[model samples]
Target: MFSGKLFLMFVATAMAQKDLSVDCGDDEWVTVRWRPELGFSQELDSSRALLGNCPPSRPASEDSLFFRVFLRDCGFIQQVTAGRVSYSNTLIYDPQPERAFISQPVQCVYDLSVGEEEPEETFSMEIMNPDFSGPAQSLRFRLGSSIPIRAVVEPRSRRPLRIYLESCEFATDANISRAAQVHPIIANAGCLMGSKAGNSSFLPRRRPDEMRLYLEAVWFAVGEQVFLHCVLEACAVQSLPVVRKACQFVPEHHRWVLLDDPSQSYACTCCDSSCLRTTDASVDGVSARKVLGPLVIVAEDPQGDASLDSQSSAGLSEAPVWLLVFAVVLVLMVCMSVLAVSYYLCFWRGGRLGYRPSRDLLTKY
Candidate 1:
């Protein structure tokens, strides 16, 4: 009976150890997923293995264990397992500095034990040169982790000449879409330059002799969807002499600025107040008319145009003073003519009845 009890105890312990489970947190969490082949390589005081994965378990005093995090889309591998992960540390295959861009390989070393019941700890990784060149991308965390992380990438701000072409011509849906796609994309991506000038009261209102244009490209990435907003502006023109002097030496060529946002997962909104300007123009012999490019006005429905026409007709319903006067005069002239005809008929009937002028002739006969 004593032998049987000892055997039962051993079986229970084995079962409990085999029943390990790991919760990788939630869907919104960001994690680095690793492949089995690329194991971590760093010196660790204690081995901290992911709770429910292969490689079974590491020794308690192994100092360090190997683990790997593979970025499927970015084609990079990050080795993170239990040691100091700093920005100064270089990634094996990455040429850019650490933290320069998202999805780049990263390594983190932490002091923890594989036998620890709970695996919960916060780690900080510094990203150097956050501005990276590449297509827009995102990082999704694996399950069983806590602590949410949010990232936003803004384009480097620059002073560029921005011009907003406003006109009424882009009233159609097709036109608006075309203009939105063509004008902003091409112009914003094109080359341009700009400079800031101090405020001046006597600055010339006339057009400049030479203008430099700068283009800014904005990318709005909300989840899987992405949209672009482009801004074109003139730069290098300033009202202050000092600013002008400084700007004079800078190149007048166009520059492109790119921005990225990941929180907006579906639709992209480009609300740039700088691009709103009077779209009307008056050219030689022609009167000022609203210029509508290919872009349609998104603020109102197509039916609104008919409503505007109705309102215009309503405004014209009020007759002018001269028109009213002419109408009154016409009525008066018709009434006068009718009265004169009645008076003439009465006189003619009375003369016939009286027969006075013929009486002297009858007396002579």
Candidate 2:
């Protein structure tokens, strides 16, 4: 009988808990509303709630607590189960140690095939020289040469868009299949994995439509035809949240900087660790996969260049000797011919004079 009374009290207290609703309506922000009994605002600790690591928006109405959290913000976590992606976070309404009241966990799921279908020509990736003026003329490059790769998103509408490279991999084949070997250059949501040894990073944005990745050609895949495969996000510039970022490690300072906005460098701190990966099929944005290929990293061969120079030098040196020999032979041949002609002319003139004198004496007799 005593247990029955306790169960009734438990049910009563549970019924008295405030009503809350989590709204994952759009891609950028999650809106959470908690409706409490009138005059109960004093009982809630707004800061203790972790809808996003940010504070809640001003109360639109006096009876409800309103929160506007960016999807990438707060302590929201993402999980992938059986190929489906979802993000979840908990909201604590009451912060009291023992008497805390927490809202039901909020989750936003996105189907991989739900986003806008990207056109074939909408996204492209190409390798460029250091100047980035045009695509690299040749795929062969010596180790340590600067290889600038650009990923572009041509606008389909007047709405301004921003492109961010989420990850990139180097592989031998254009299509990076699961069986194919791949080296991740940029992964974990923009961490430059190659920066530990070389300067590989996403460059600061010159325009919102295109993003450039600066990679130093390394001997990692020398003598092999390598390709770059990248996964990028195209988001509406107007509704962009703090989540859209490109980061690179600065070796000089041993730190990371956000290429798009250095003032928000704190966002890049996650490069040292792991950054949350979120995939959403929203009308505001879409993800694209692009490939740039057939790049050959040629090992520098100083001996080969030296051998060519030596061969040219030897040919030049032998040419002068052959010309000298030919000039000497020609001079001797010309002197011999002149001497033979002079002997023939002198002999003919002597014979003619003797014959003329004999004929004149016989005629006179």
User: TM-score winner among the candidates?
Assistant: 2
Which lDDT values do the candidates have, in the order given? 0.23, 0.63
Q: Write the per-residue lDDT of candidate 2 for residues 12-88, one digit (tens) a residue.
A: 11223457665554344567776543234455545544342334676336546687665544435544444344556
Q: Scored by Cα lDDT, where does model 2 land?
A: 0.63
Model 2 ranges with Cα > 4 A deviation: 1-121, 178-180, 238-240, 278-283, 301-365
Model 2: worst 10 consecutive residues (lDDT sum): 1-10
What is the clash tally of candidate 2? 2
lDDT of 1 by residue, 102-194 (tens): 111232222223342221221121111113233213221112111111112111234222122111111112322222122222211111111
Regions of candidate 1 where Cα sits further than 4 Å from its true position: 1-228, 231-318, 348-365
lDDT measured at residue 258 in model 1 versus the true structure, 0 to 100: 19
